[model samples]
Target chain A: MTAATQPQRTGRVRRVGERQEALAGYAFIAVPMALFLVLNIGTTLYAFFISVWDWNVRTGPRSFLGLGNFERLLNDDIFLIAVKNSLYYTVIWVPLTMAIGLFLAVIVNQKIRGRTFFRAAFYFPAIASSAAITILWIFLVQPGGLFDEIRGALGLNPLFAAMGYGPTHNWMGDPATAMNSIIILNAWTTSGTFMLFYLAALQSISNDVYEAAAIDGAGAWQTFWRVTFPLLRPGHFFVATVGVIGALQLFDQVRIGGGPNGDPNNALMSVVLYLYNAAFIQVNLDYAAAVGVVLFLVIFAAPLVQRRIFGSGPAW
Target chain B: MSTDPPAAAQRPPRAAVDQLAGRIPSLAETEDVGPVGDRSRAWRKRIAYALMIGYALLMFVPFAWTVITSFKTRADALRLEVIPDPFTLQGWEYTFARLDPSIVTLFINSALIATAVTVTNLVLGSLGGYAFARLRFPGREVLFVVVLATLMIPDQLRLVPVYVLFNNFGLTRDVGQYIGVILVLAISATSIFLLRQYFLSIPKDLEEAARIDGAGFFTTFYRVMLPLATPALAAVTILQFQGTWNGFFWPVILLRDRDHYTIPIGLLFFRESGGFSTNWPPLMAVVVIATIPILILYIFFQRYFVEGVAASGVKG
Candidate 1:
């Protein structure tokens, strides 16, 4: 697909250094090319090979299994649960991140006061380690912790009750709320980076459009819907696509937040975490490789499907 | 047509006023009808600003908690009080001095790995990026596409096979694990793409002029291209450094020994070893240590962080 966009080779002045230039070029690219091949491309292909074999690390055993790993993955209940949880994460995480991100971007993009401070504040979490954030979130949601305290102060239990959910409790401890808590934390932490993306896109948008829309008697809401939203489509698309890709690979937060075993009835089980367990915890190297291949396929296909749905646009 | 001296003098000031007014968004474009419209618009702006501040505070809670809890006594940490009743140096002292001398080791390990990864990516990524961006070589497009394709294959997909690969080589056994992790991240697609964007944006004349002056490809790249690409270099360096510092999954898999563990992995080990009843103060203190360096770097280099992030998105 990208090949069509490859620029044509510009005319080069053929000189004594021409042959040497090609040689040096090859030499320059040699290290990264080899590293990419052996570590990235080669290992990716090796994952496929390992998946077809019954490999056990502890006993150092390997036997041909063909598509047996793939077949087994289909019936693997934990793997299936992981798939479901990952989907749930992506579904909730992507839209929440994009909406909040775009909203913050619009706010900061405006000619308002202290935008620099707001932008930095919103973005700080995005730069922090996920593990650290998960720890902080856990502390916040612990019994009588900051989150709980704030929730009580705000009378959020009634709001939850109004939505037919039970009154406030330990968010990470309860299975029903565990994944939801994770979704909230992940969305909150990640939205900052996407906000930066949207901010760039928002700033790139010319002011004339808004002025024109205003002159045409469009209200603020109408101007946003007709002009700003459409113009910010590329930012929305980028943020969403990246968000889904990232959300599906959810492991760090789950591993740290819900505990490694995906505690509370596996509410936070993610495919990557599942694969990690299979390989490291269970010593089933081949099975993990199979899961890896499946993950590769999912990650590969997600962007293509997203592009089809969102319509790819040139991002700022 | 009405260019009277007073009118002309007024004309310039009038144009400037019109520009200023045009720039300031009106309370409403329609006939104001009454002062109520202006008041309501002012109210809306105030509400928007208030919401922005509210969200910023929400985002800051975790950070504030991390900071305050780090100085608190264990009991104080468990309490909902925003301030520590008896703030002490015990947590910081324990984290740095007594907890595990290897906490210091973990910091060193993270620093070493981060530096190695950043330096390697800068040199090799730039070389490959320069080759693709400027050099004429056979199969450049195809090779470039292959490198770009690696970005789509999620790191999880590489996890098991790479674990197996490192295990077979005995890299998972000790300090070799550092090599294992570094090799995995050495040629990041994002870094290469970022550098390629930077290289492409630079004028070709400099390199051409250098070549005409008898400088070969490598020399021209080093002397002319590399110097001009400092901004991209800094951007990618910060990105790679922060990424490696924040890395959790690979470190968990590759480094089994606590001595070899990076900050994230060590923190996980710290958490696991302490279990649920672990005192919060030292834990928070350890997390602060892990976080502070990256936070400082980010605060200083916020501009490049945004640029690198936005540029990476643009590539995608």
Candidate 2:
């Protein structure tokens, strides 16, 4: 038996069960990859195809319209508003969320008393479904709502009260404030997730570094900037990348917060909401796909630029 | 106005430190940095904590308001009182009874769909993870890279085509809705890839020895790999469970009939109830109920959560 299995150096006279072993490996990936291809990959392709055609469920598919859908999208005013609002949200929310997240991570990562409680409390919002919280946030941001009540108590809502849309806190109804309301809500719900990422990165930093810094006479500020920030460069990059992706894909909160029409004058109409409107609300699947394709390019291009600039990992 | 200017205008350096410096031990809050320096650091820390705490309070305020309003009459609710006075359960009862039958069924639909999705994801994801980790076949790295590439697709970009395909598949309604949701969720590449990395990090000597003992690939997988990979599995379990539980867009798209709607989708029908009514109370109640399982798991398995998330990047 030994001589029968002796090396011919071809590596082909392997175990009797080589096929089964390979089959096992293949089996593992097959189911998930198939589902992924069906739901994720297929949808991506289909969306791209739909974008170029005049496909509507009622009227059926037709010849491709090249970039006509995108032309329409560019001129749609509402689409322009959506694109602008998303950018505004991204620019405002990313830095605010990062600052808060880092602050919380630094606090809780110090392993203070009631640290677990603080962590749980901070993470509670993240655990609740986005839809549920968006609904609750709409309630809070409404006139005479929780924020307005607190604002009135603090006497900071002078102008809003003077205007009088109820308590003149009709945050979503007023086109001027709808986008800001959504951004604030985004920061609140998602900061916890960012906090967790920072916490994870913070914990991975060696404690010996802190001890060494203490001996060198470096103060807290010095420790954070010199030792901590440099060490956390990788984590910072990751959060930035993930944050951009998430912000670009914003949908649930805006849709639920602003309602089906995306608030007055489409002030809060994000790209995803616009796409949903085209496909489901207006039944223009092709044009919706066109919007999706634009978003995909925008999202995918940012990461490519990020990769070029960051050049992979911390320079250190 | 009398701020110190470096060494020129410095007071005797707040000799509080010198008084006890030699005799006393390390004080974390030493005014040792400089006068304004110490206060600024303290101020920054305080501001950080205040921002975090204020944000957290703002997030919870809506839920708190809902709870308070849930126990009040519509007249009291309209008045927007600080405290819920003359409390009653009528709002809660109205939410449960006055709501359509579809709203009540939403809880069960959401629960069943989430549970199914979670179960399928676990089984499929863990198996793929195990194979990817242990079984190094031809082109394994290429396959994994392809799988990881899928993560780059923004979820919003995939909505249109997926909805269309599901409509074509006869899985868009009734009992099939849960199946459709489960299928969509089952393709998660993260958990599968994560578990695989965790599995690979384990020493393969035991598995090798099992193979030498003539145990088949399936046997080795079940006996050695699965047991040691329990923590990874648990982490993925909670992660996928929470993700599926909170799935809003899918449940909305796939379940057209209100009766088949999940909790988030079901709660949405309450918006049609009136401008504001007792219906909001029950929706809030349902939100609380829906969040309980996820909160419990997250609190209990926070460590694993940290591990899973960290390992994800390490593998990437």
Each predicted complex: what DockQ? 0.41, 0.29
- Candidate that would win on DockQ: 1
Best by lDDT: 1
Evaluate fnat for each of the predicted models and list the values in order: 0.60, 0.50
Give the Cα error of residue B148 in candidate 1, in Å. 0.6
Lowest-lDDT window of 10 residues in candidate 1 chain A?
A4-13
Give per-residue lDDT, candidate 2, residue A272.
86
Candidate 1 lDDT at B230 equals 82
User: CA lDDT, every prediction?
Assistant: 0.81, 0.72
For B165-280, candidate 1 gives per-residue lDDT tens digits of 88889888877889988888887989999888778877678888997898877888998888878877998999999999999888888888778888887777777775423678
Candidate 1: pairs in clash: none
Candidate 2 chain A: 10-residue stretch with minimal lDDT: A8-17
Per-residue CA lDDT of model 1 for A76-123, tens digit only, reads 899899999999889988998899888777676655678678988998
